[model samples]
Target chain A: MELVELLKTVELFEGLTQAQLQRLAEISEPARYDKDTVIFEQGQQGDRLYIVGSGEVVVRVGEDPRSARTQVYLGRGQIFGEMALLDGGPRSATTVCSRNGTQVYGVSREAFTNLCKSDTAIGYVVMRNMAHDLSFKLRHHNLTLV
Target chain B: MIYKVSYVVSGGRHPGAIMNEYERPQLGDRVEIGDKVFEVTEVLEMTPPRGDFQYLHVTVRLVDENENP
Candidate 1:
């Protein structure tokens, strides 16, 4: 699938115009990983966010990689590692390629921020959608703990 | 057919919609999120298919503690 069309399925990129999605696509780099490859380890400094293009990726967390537990399974059209891109923080979890030939489209913080600077509309919509998703996640996590 | 699912587990929605395995998950199948494994109890259409993509909402519950992975 075209990058722009894949971006359309993601909730975070919701509301972007075709032109805006095209701009994001242009800056994106599509990468493929073999099964079991560690895409990024928890606590590592990260500047890029990835959108899965095919196959599967797993997000897990633990102080030690061996002890880490599966956090979520991400597949085509889903975004992982977004928090780091938005905040310049260390990765909160380890994301691994769970299936062979898994592919992801990555956009670095520098490139994304540059695009955002050039088009505030992109920044506004993406940030707003991200906030909405984060709030839902926070709410769900807190409730599940009870 | 491409079936993408958003899972709601143990009475709360998962932070994000997370699904895209080649085989569609059916009722009684197991799902994992975070450290928890859930059993699918209900499946509903979240939205109609968009081109080749079909969206679904899967409601599940934590399996008995003894059944955990």
Candidate 2:
């Protein structure tokens, strides 16, 4: 699917118009990962977020690979690395391509920040969506402890 | 109310933690820890062979906050 279409399917881009999505698409680049490829390691400096185009990606925690635990598995249309991209923080976990030929679309923090700066409307909607996503995750995490 | 719980990863134990008891956690729940959000894809409850301790193993999948599919 096209980048705009893919972005529309992402929850972070929800409520964004086609024109805005097109602009985002222009700033995005295609990425690919081979099976067992480490997309990013925990503690690495992060500056980009990825949207899965195809295949599966696994998110893991722990320092040792031999004992590393899988945190989550991502499939098509899923997004990752946004937390680092938004906060300019180190990655909290590692990501690996679990399936061969995994494909993704990536957007750099610089480009995304610039887009937000130039278009407050797009920024507002995207930020709001991201906040909503974070809230949902927080709620879920809290529930697990219950 | 807050619920007392233990946080386990790959069979190792992190410090026990507490969370609010608003929405009960179930399979497929999405959770955020630090800079990542993961989905609760699996939950495994275990009892040691000779111990009185019961363990809950929760497996989560990393997911995009905005993904609909």
Candidate 3:
């Protein structure tokens, strides 16, 4: 996918102009994965944060059975692993390809951190949005348990 | 110099675990994770190993830009 087009589709750049989008696009690393492949595993070191450009992926937490779990099915333009990206921590969950997929953008922890520090507007927007999304997920999980 | 720092690692659960595992702080030093800043308040000499690595114990205080000792 074209860099400009990909950036427009991501939530983090929702309000940015095309020129700003292009600048953000230049920093991403595009990658592809097949169905059932593990993008990241729980307890492993985390470095790359991903955004889906095509197809679906699943995020599963905990162990093989009897573990707390959730299935997050992501479509094009969705992002994952933000918590790991923001903090230097182990993967809190495992992400796997639910279908053969292609993701156009993935960023390293150092680059993500540097961008947050250097661009206050962008940093505020990203952090605010993520906090909302995480709260929403917590609410959803609570609903599921009820 | 490489120093040991242990700040308030987590508020709960995963945050707590990650902080417990990686943070080792020493007095007079500071660390920043995301937008949060933590300072080392006390240093304790203790070694704990993970795989092939050795670690120290430290106590820290989470501080803001305006916080003073």
Fnat of candidate 3, please? 0.00
Q: Select the stronger candidate by DockQ from 2 and 3.
A: 2
> In terms of TM-score, which candidate is strongest?
1
Of 1 and 2, which scores higher on lDDT? Answer: 1
lDDT of 3 by residue, A1-146 (tens): 68787655455555566765665676788888887788888888888778777665667788662574544455465577877877879889888776665453687877766776877676676677567446544543333333
List the pairs of residues colliding in candidate 1. A71-B34
Fill in the DockQ of model 3: 0.01
TM-score of each: 0.74, 0.65, 0.60
- Candidate 2 lDDT by residue in tens digits, B1-69: 112112332222221221222234577676543345556666554222112112244555656668863
lDDT of 1 by residue, A71-116 (tens): 6677676788988987888999999998889889999999999999
- Ranking of models by DockQ: 1, 2, 3
Which scores better on TM-score, 1 or 2?
Answer: 1
lDDT of 1 by residue, B1-69 (tens): 556676766555444337564567899998655455788888877666644456676778878779744
Q: What is the lDDT of residue B19 in candidate 1?
A: 58
Q: CA lDDT of each candidate?
A: 0.76, 0.66, 0.57
TM-score of chain A of each: 0.90, 0.91, 0.84
Cα lDDT over the full model 1 = 0.76
